[model samples]
Target: MCMAHKSCVSEADSAAAAAALFAWGANSYGQLGLGHKEDVLLPQRLSNFCEPGCIKSVTGGGGHSAAVTGRKAKPSSLLVAKNQGKTCALYITSIGSGNVDVILQRGSPWTAGVLIIISNIRRSSLLPPFMCLVCCILLLYDCPDGGSLFVCGLNKDGQLGLGHTEDVLCFTICKPLLGCPIRQVACGWDFTIMLTVSGSVFQWGTGLASSGRRLCAGQTLPLFLTAKEPSRVMGLEDSTAVCVVAGSDHSASLTDTGELYVWGRNKHGQLASLAAFLLLPQRIDARCFQDEKVTAVWSGWTHLVAQTETGKVFTWGRADYGQLGRRLESPEGQKPHKQDSQLTFWRPQSSVSLPLCCLTGAAKISCGSEHNLAVISDKCFSWGWNEHGMCGDGTESNVWTPSPVQALQSPSRILLVGCGAGHSLALCQLPALSEPCQDVKVIYTLQADTGNPESQNGMNKERNRKERQSVTSTQSNSDRTRNEGP
Candidate 1:
């Protein structure tokens, strides 16, 4: 996801640099040395995995799944596992004590929320792995239906669910979770939470979470703050979560039953309260949307946004630059509010109050460091800071009202859109499916306001927005009907 430069190594190349053909592993981290994170990697292309008779063996280890691909004309062995689903992943695989192949099973018409995690590679887990000394730590949760929610990075306090205190290098499959079938995973600084389809909750890590202890002394509520492994929450057995999102130090979970559960820091009212922080996952009420069920919820570094079935958007938390919608100013003075620069709130502010809230069925929203963007069908709408035009509203001015990007408004249908700390990008495809060679690619622009050479480049960044690139596809032969692997 680096934009400093444009270089990508294919998965095979990402392995040990196969064929040195500018493949994935060939330029791992794009010279940034961003080290390992998750999953198994072997020297093979995604095409080889799908090609008949192209794979010879597939190995499932303690926390990883790998395959040895064999090509017909020039067969070679390469351990492999192709991502079959579109979901977020936080993994780093190594061949150590873990040898559990991550599996996901579903029961009846209830689809499995297979949000799988393959390791607890805590803080020091990135020390580099040896060929024979690699280990894996993996966990699974149903995504969409009960999946996604991957947790990785530092866990020095046993916040990771590997059941041990040692930091992990590669993703080590958490063997204990194989039988539990997880629905989602949410991570706080040194803690993690897991949700199950049956409405069960399990948490791990230091702080009040490591012990799964509830502080009842000065507290009048149930606390599931600290634990070293996945522990079930006492009262959440009847709750079912449909969506989950995390901020830097706080977390939020929305249940199908029209309830919101929050925990962790709330210094700025990000958790909908005045309390400094919460050690337990407490159900916080949103007074503004009291009667409507939240359809989606998103968390920024210190802000929160929610949408209702009526296409209503509610925002709160740090609104320094109007991150909480167009509520930056007061009606009397028509200027930025008194708390606009310093105070933060957790209460939901109406989006309709803003001049651009009528999005005509706005369906989704994405947040950035201090900006926000939304999508309705093929068009995208943005608001907030325009210091570097992160709003993509065709100007470098701060905009509190949502407006569609004119540059990306036609000839093609939007396929995907993303927002980053300093830049924003969109993917589009020609609607002419009848044209076999239609191109689909990303359009990028600089949205960061860092006043440097790159910042100067931001002024001339318009040229890069029109750049188009196409990905290659694989063709199957008649003999490719049968494929085999270990």
Candidate 2:
């Protein structure tokens, strides 16, 4: 189920501005796109969406916002009738639980578009109740031409691929894509990129993995690269990828050959001793681990996690915060105990440890800002930061080892899992209504916002005003109520 905010508008100019500013969830750093650096307890109007002949879109990030707009026009026939009539078109889209209302001086506004929300789901209601909350969303679009927009990560640089640098509270189409037909899109924190069916890759946004500098702070255009010569990634020739996943500053691609290639940032050993940042993809050697057939891979800010076809997980990179889930004893004077008796007091190789033993039966995994979670068949486990009760163990302490989240100890079966900077979400298949089913419960323990209860209530009042506007119009309220998920 989903939780969202709602809004509505009546003026064209006001709608144009309102389409540019809005916020939901945590607004620390103005990431909600509300044009301010304050937390919004509830949905409130960032601006009015009553502009005539206006085209607009908005998106959200970890702590930032983005928006786009274009010229507007009225239908010629409608204009002729309005010369004797009085009516205008209103365009509206809902992202998360927040409602977006846009006014246009034209024919009927596009009724079919896409909606994206950053929220979460629970994997199992049977687990013991804990406070960990997952963040993700649903993507509803009407691209009848068989096109799809891939949504993951935040746009640190217009890289959410929504054609703007603003945080997208909802799903916005990647506009004006040309030449190669984009089959999928992926995002790193400050960058956005796309892969085409023709084996070509396009990239935009911030940071040069090679120079360690910004390639383009915020890009709206797609830049194509020829994976030949110096720009070519190793071991990708004649190979096609089936899936791609991005982390905070890195990315990974899975080939049809069951091979995995990774690129981008490597601080904290996320890239397995590749010193400098990788501008091109490099093949991962699965033979180094017991599992040779990798079925899935995931990443966090500074670490890597992957699952094999046999339900095994392998992790590398930063162990700080236990992101890697590997056991490590504090070093004694910068040296570790020697396990080999053949060596005579020799220094151990500077190598990162891999915890192949700890990650058994893990079918899926997710990484938060500083923590990690894994789903083993019907059960879920978490490690790392618990500061906001993200670990779901009902404590504010951090765990350096993997621990089962007792809060999820219900009888339902979990299907999917996701994580935000400090929160987590799971999707579970509950028992049918005819059977004994439990209500899907959501728990929030993130740092609470400091604000007067009256002020918070006032925000809700504004949200109610917007909802009333939407009801007065012909748009369906079903879009606004999608946040009530299970």
Candidate 3:
């Protein structure tokens, strides 16, 4: 899977970078982006992305699905926007370096409206002539590449980020995130989490606060009490967030340093805390993950999937639907139940209770409402809810253990997999004739490289030269022995 903050160039070059998008499952609101509202039992190629290398990432929520499309733009481009009715010329330079020096001029004090500069660029510096007045409203997000965000499906709660709650019948540009170069988007039941090129995160739609709990008991609170427009998540300013993920009623963000912060509803202990709600970001205890740096994380409706550097998969939260991908243990001398629906909850009591390891060697993982998909050793494995064949097992039964999706065991290498509420999407790259089964040999590390590309190329060339020399030596030795007739 592509790292949440991967550069557009790297994403396009990836073996799994989605040249075409394939989706199956629920399409009640046309979230499938297939130009129809009918449900698809089998995976079907999305006509919208007929052009190879157009699709970057795919995500969905309760009933809406979205995809990030477009290749990386040229290194730098002059962006022109009207700020406070004064024509502003903004010269953004060195975007590919991840740190940009934005030079804006001829712009007076800003008034209403926020200008979000989204690119796949990195860190940013605001130069002279760029100023926000007392009445000016300006919001800028940075990243390194340029791309478009498209959404289709239910917008009952504005999950599509289109600035309205009307259900979308076809793929539409998310207006709020339109200008910003998006790195990726994570969808919740009624909200959306957007990550920009600059490692900034924004959220919109109804709040993710819990509906079952009152702040102090006997107190009533509004069900949807969050931003209607995209708002930056405040606490994340301290650290650059590389990845953002969302559950049915909660969300989480991961920093480049491997810190995971969670918020929203905790009714099912999805936040790893006993509190009923977390209005702000809170760090999950490292001990819960065995004190290992979590390299990646994915979420279901009420469960979470985390992978460590060692590729061990850790899971927590609701397990009734077999979403946890592990068997629940009972008290001493008591046997675990055969049926998962009645199993005890896997709530972590502080850091004392740790999340259980479901599987190992998971290179990447994606979670649906109650199902998960992982690419292990170049093959895809699935578990949990199979109703609607979201697990891609050609069955409607819930999967109790990690099982290989026979349909995905193809000659093409599985580059990445994504899951919506009741559907699945896989980004694969077919093998070239020159390199047979090269997908198995090349591991998708998904880690961002900060080194110079030229230097990397030089290293690759050196390694290839050594490999050729070794091959030639072996062949020469074989020939010499054959000539000696010994």
Candidate 4:
């Protein structure tokens, strides 16, 4: 999400940009937020977020989904005051925060405001009066003003962070994170990882597996753990992490200084270490990265993807599904190994490089259990497992190489991309039209299965006008319904 500048667009205009939510694929546990537990073959709109700029960030896990949504505070001229010898403008703005509970059982979304605090501002006389700006400006914030975590779906392992092991039928707030602002959240098979703005890491649900585990070679140990409540993770005392990633059974973090730390299951060398499992965070060997500072890291069920400041990408771990995005050459420089084979323990799994031809110049990357998505400029490319049409290429065959998602190759700018166990999500900000109107057309594209994707739907000038009217009418009825309770 990008910040809005007043010079280019007003705050109210940004807030009213109509950034909608679209989801597809597996909904067995209603993880797609589509109001029912039916598998969608193509992208479908999740009706609740159609209102302008309501959704902040969205993510999904094995059988669940979560999103952070809220309104942003606008800079306003609180008053003009005198300071020292000159008259200085005293400005103040209340940072707005809220959350919406999507009760999948009922399927209607409702908004609930959270913590509202005063944000720091420099005194200025040029500040304008109070008014709502554009939806894009506020909804795109990395950390909304006091974000609230709303989660729903299978929580039998207490992965929802609601202080209980029972499954959540509605989107409920994580009790421990009530007033605290969250920076990021990552969901694993039966656990969840959270990163706060202060860089504190939290984990909940079942911990790393305990069977046949050892800290080092020949050291027998048995350890099992579970946290129904969110617990702060240790071992990252020396550095602050800027991002966090969670695979099916492993977790990772990238520090502000560019160091990479990984923990948990190493069944397929996902930890980049020889240890079978890591109970605490351990920095990956810099030598394996060619001494380059890692810029970003993403994970799948048993593989890891990383990008360096030099624009180089490296992948390791389970490659039988082509999730590595490139071939692994044999030690003898023989022919590239087959994708269905596993990496030998002797091979330097940490140093495997993603071929430049496979992927280059990607602005962002996301990984599902066995697939990947990359957005470069205006196009989104997908590869690996597509059994559920998660690759969005209108097919169920596994994609061994990067292929463009024709539906998303449009003038609309891609804002964010996310993946789940067998589904994919892409949030796009549609271009503004030349004519003036109260609302802008925002389309949500959820990639679930294979068929002609709805994104291919053609729109002429008159059709677009009618769709805009329909959106307006829907919003109007929504507003009236809110005012006139049934």
Q: Highest lDDT, which number?
A: 4
lDDT of candidate 3 at residue 142, scale 0 to 100 = 36
**Residue range 279-345, candidate 1, lDDT tens digits:** 6667755454646667777776567788766777777666656666665444431232224468743
Best by TM-score: 4
Candidate 4 per-residue C-alpha lDDT over 55-135 given as tens digits, one digit per residue, 9 for 90 to 100: 444554444444444343222221122233443222112111112222322321212322111111221111122111100
TM-score, every prediction: 0.56, 0.54, 0.55, 0.59
Model 4 misplaced regions, further than 4 Å: 1-49, 52-55, 61-182, 204-206, 212-232, 330-345, 348-358, 430-486
* Candidate 3 local lDDT, 1-112, one digit each (tens): 0000111323333444334445666555555666666655445555433343444555554454544333432212223344566533332111111122223334423221
TM-score, ranked from best to worst: 4, 1, 3, 2
Whole-model lDDT, candidate 2? 0.46
> Model 1 lDDT vs. the true structure?
0.45
**lDDT by candidate, in order shown:** 0.45, 0.46, 0.56, 0.57
User: What is residue 312's positional error in candidate 1, in angstroms?
Assistant: 1.1
User: Which scores greater on lDDT, model 2 or model 3?
Assistant: 3
Q: Cα lDDT for residue 451, model 2?
A: 26
Off by over 4 Å in 2: 1-176, 197-200, 209-235, 332-358, 431-486
What does each candidate score in C-alpha RMSD?
13.3, 15.5, 16.5, 14.5
Clashes of each: 78, 63, 14, 15
Question: If both were scored by lDDT, which would come out higher, candidate 1 or candidate 2?
Answer: 2
**Looking at candidate 2, what is the lDDT of residue 43?**
24
